[model samples]
Target chain A: MKTDQEGAVRSDALLSSWKQTPTRQAIVDYVDRALQEGGAEYVPPSERVAVFDNDGTLWCEKPMPPELGFILQRLAEMAEQDPSLRTRQPWQAARDKDYAWLGDVITKHYHGDDSDVRVLMGGILQAFAGMSVDAYAEIADRFLRTTPHPTLGRQLWRCTYLPMVELLRYLEANGFTTYIASGGDRDFMRPVTEELYGIPAERIIGTTAGLRYQDDDTGGSVVYQAEMEVFDDGPTKPVRIWSRVGRRPVVAGGNSNGDIQMLRYAGQPSRPGLRLLVLHDDEEREFNYTAGAETSLEQARAQDWTVVSIKNDWATVFADEV
Target chain B: MKTDQEGAVRSDALLSSWKQTPTRQAIVDYVDRALQEGGAEYVPPSERVAVFDNDGTLWCEKPMPPELGFILQRLAEMAEQDPSLRTRQPWQAARDKDYAWLGDVITKHYHGDDSDVRVLMGGILQAFAGMSVDAYAEIADRFLRTTPHPTLGRQLWRCTYLPMVELLRYLEANGFTTYIASGGDRDFMRPVTEELYGIPAERIIGTTAGLRYQDDDTGGSVVYQAEMEVFDDGPTKPVRIWSRVGRRPVVAGGNSNGDIQMLRYAGQPSRPGLRLLVLHDDEEREFNYTAGAETSLEQARAQDWTVVSIKNDWATVFADEV
Candidate 1:
């Protein structure tokens, strides 16, 4: 019910950080219609749940997801202690800088059988076992602070899309509870999500591992166990959302095939919902290849979901340096 | 930084619904100390996480938890179709109204080994498999609307402690994000948590079951799978809190040994936190037996955690009738 000085509902100011375009205007109109009292599309505040895919939708994922960099750094550190790690599929891929092997692992896990995916996930978990949550978070934080994106030439954390950040705040101003349903590691994302997207740790759902509480000779702490708990991607995304959030989302956004199931789930037949896909076609400002997201773009066009062209919709991709 | 017309911080109005007591005063003082600008105990709003046990801490659990009632009803309905259920351990106990057998099952599972606990939880998950989330919620809602507490003679939902409800709102008013960490079924609690405690489905963390999304001959819907996802109780309480919330709670309240680990976790050595135990000692208003909570009471005294006596701390147990 909040209004700006001009007496317009505050959600109207959404996407002000973006270039004025039909896509931005469409989104603002959709939000306004859903929030207006007595309107046909008006949704109760409690049911106005919005979900966003974190990697490419909110921040840069090209030149690899920042978590992959963190993982590679972790693998290198582990390989130093255990020479056996240098020969493993994921570890060898990281050590030898084998993009083809890494890409194959990721693609196979996404489109392969359940057991193969579990094996890949299990390997990732085993590498992180015995690590305390605080220690793991410190590793991620250090990587964010020191590492610059290979292509963007900026600190990885600073590469978030400014327009998407505005969209998040705008939805919240209209009483929507926004959540991040990413395919990244849940623990790794939690340490920086609040700082980056104004989303709390509890509001972020992603791949998780089993944790064990231990009190031993050293001290009392909870340590991550080497077991995949939830794989939050593709079909699992909708299932995890149903289990964790309970409410079906009214708005969903993503930029890849990994998010197709979640987007479809949010667009329930009985409800009025918004589904958006961000197309990474702006090579000048941001990396512009859709190497793994071709199917997502095709689906967006076929289903009439809004597709935001990064070059056309966003005027700025990052905050100006102070 | 919210204040009343008299310029006093607003959380002072927190437990106004309850009779003023030393315990209430102590709680208010603790919260205020943690919120003061430059106080040693000052905690930022983002880190102000509070957790509450649902059963005895917020509502009546004596004469058995209300969920048991719903479970029994469900068992009876299932028995009508499958008579073999009447011969099973849990189903037979519910069908025959054998409290002793049910009590033994609960106690044994709590004190038993990991495999024993898993078997018990697995049985529970099997009973609820194939049930849609919406359908399950409707069943819980219907039971709540008609069923009455055996001793209080009020609708089951009406048996919630008014004082604790006030406390939950008070914490929220002061920027605390409150969560219900219960041993009850997550799906069962979600149906009524919003109405009973002002907590949404997402904030209620409890024992969960695996879910599968299937597009069958009928239609596409998410169904409960026959698997124990997380048995959130005792040691698992703190573990689940770390996994789900990703922040250690600043305050935790419970009423039984099932909550001991969570209480201890909240009372970390390095942080300023509050741990509260609710003791049922008001026979006239509600049940007054601590049959299973003696260890919790002993720990409360040993650890200097605040203990709330239902007889002394609350002026009213339930809301006034219309």
Candidate 2:
């Protein structure tokens, strides 16, 4: 139960005696009205779907995305194992700790210039395959347990916005189904989501790799491939969502222009939906430079998407339990 | 360990004893020689993928494909629940038990003459969504367990060819990966393959309706939709398998011309691979007239693919253990 303050429930005070932020309250109020009082005008409980971007929105994307860390680890391992990898342009740059060339390599990979995408994906497959599904889950658990934010020095799991986690729980408590519609690798995320977020692998839709299944023939074991699939980024987010999940989400959460189409897709007046864009307005506690940060937050505001100011909306940025 | 009459250890005789078929032995011997003696010059393990068409090639396709049965069950349920569905052309034909017209309606749906494909698939989604993934697996299991052949009066599971099953195991034992690249719906096949044939959901590539993952707030479960997607029939088989699996299968098994493109893609001398076409030469045990069948097998033979005679090569068809 939530304490009613004005026309909306004070989200912060509901579970604890924390102050309720305006933007969080406003979003909560809108959802409550839509689900309860909006009636036939709004989508029914059955159709009430909410999709959320993982990084930057639900969690931090500051120094680097989580996947970049995985990439960095792989690059370091390869450099140590194969001396020739140190001589390779991008690998050499990474070995020298010069990350300026990373963007160029990524661009080349996307444009089909540097190396065969299949071959590159083969590396991922070889690394991940043959390991049990449980082994991967354990790795994710360990990563989340040990890794802390460089700036805040808070555990990465603790770095998840307190209000947003509540929002997901609140939506679930109500008749709203929530999903982490991320741009990360589907396999990478699947291993951790169920434990961290209570979201199952079936519900967590994301970028995937092409996989081949083969029977190990011991008892019932099967081997799977981990080749890179269609990257779910920018405008391709909505397109990939439609292909993989096959329905327009009723509500969507995003942080930057990368999520514009996803928000827009949810914002269509024809479908009863809600879209929220998280704006990084807190600079004291977190690195905040809206419209100018490397992640393209400017174009999102230009589109007139509903922006939630973190400085004003969130009373506590990270979880108190940790 | 298996011993031959000459006191030599036979590589495949372990699986061969369980299978006990002349056709199975022939396939094992051929593939074994190609991999061992032929070396890298002949069959590389990377190119040792074997794809089998599900319906007739692997299981019984007599009355109809299993997916069609599932679809028909869904259609009947929808027609009964929604009276308006009876007024629709295909539904009306289905309600009246006009299977000939139903076939025509299905053809129109696939060939793009009728809008029934979308509506029918929507009906399937509504019918199956919210059903637990476990329950769906049970439905497939029950169908395989209880459903008997129309003419043979034996269970449909018993209709699975012993030789083919052994061949699948033999291929996997040796470095070959097997896949069911079929014209059947992909999700529909997912529930049954692992239990029946040792293939996992990740490896089974087939026709699919577009599935949407929704957090069903009402039921607290993820729901999948069975909406029409790019159907894996005729020429689409090869393209879908490559795109979905991202690997060209080296050895392909298909019983009809619907599988021609897949077989051609696998068997091309342009690449190093083997294609085996299963000829339905057994009229006494199963329907033998492939020329007049829904899938024209004669057209496949014209491609000069190696034809496996079901009647001549096999000492046994189905397992008597059941």
Second chain TM-score, each model: 0.91, 0.79
**lDDT (10s digit) by residue, model 1, range B102-204:** 6666666545435534544555676789998778888888887789888787888798899999899888887789999998888888988998899989988
Q: Tell me candidate 2's fraction of native contacts, as a decimal between 0 and 1.
A: 0.00
Candidate 1 achieves a global lDDT of 0.79
Which residue pairs clash in candidate 1? none
Q: What is the DockQ of each candidate?
A: 0.47, 0.03
Provide C-alpha RMSD values for all models, in order.
3.3, 14.3
Candidate 2 DockQ vs. native: 0.03
Off-target runs (Cα >4 Å) in candidate 1 are: A1-12, A113-123, A215-220, B1-12, B17-21, B113-123, B215-220
**Could you list the iRMS of every candidate?**
2.9, 12.3
Worst 10 residues of 1 chain B by lDDT: B1-10
lDDT of 1 by residue, A1-322 (tens): 4322321345456566778788987788778777666767777788889999989999898767888778877766767778898887567766777767665666665455455446456567878999988788888777886788887767887988889998899888877899999998888888888998999888889988878877542224678988877778888888888777888888999998898878877746555788899999988998787766778888788878899999988888888741
Interface RMSD of 1: 2.9
| lDDT by residue (tens digit), candidate 2, B1-322 | 2212221134446354333355454465556555663344256655677889987788867656666666666677678889999887556655676667655545574344646655655566666765644356567667667766667667776778777787787777777788888877666677667767888665677765443323322212223444454567666776556544434677888877677667666734434556677777788866674542234355445544556677776667777855
lDDT (C-alpha) at residue B242 in model 1: 78
Compare the candidates by TM-score and give the number of the best one.
1
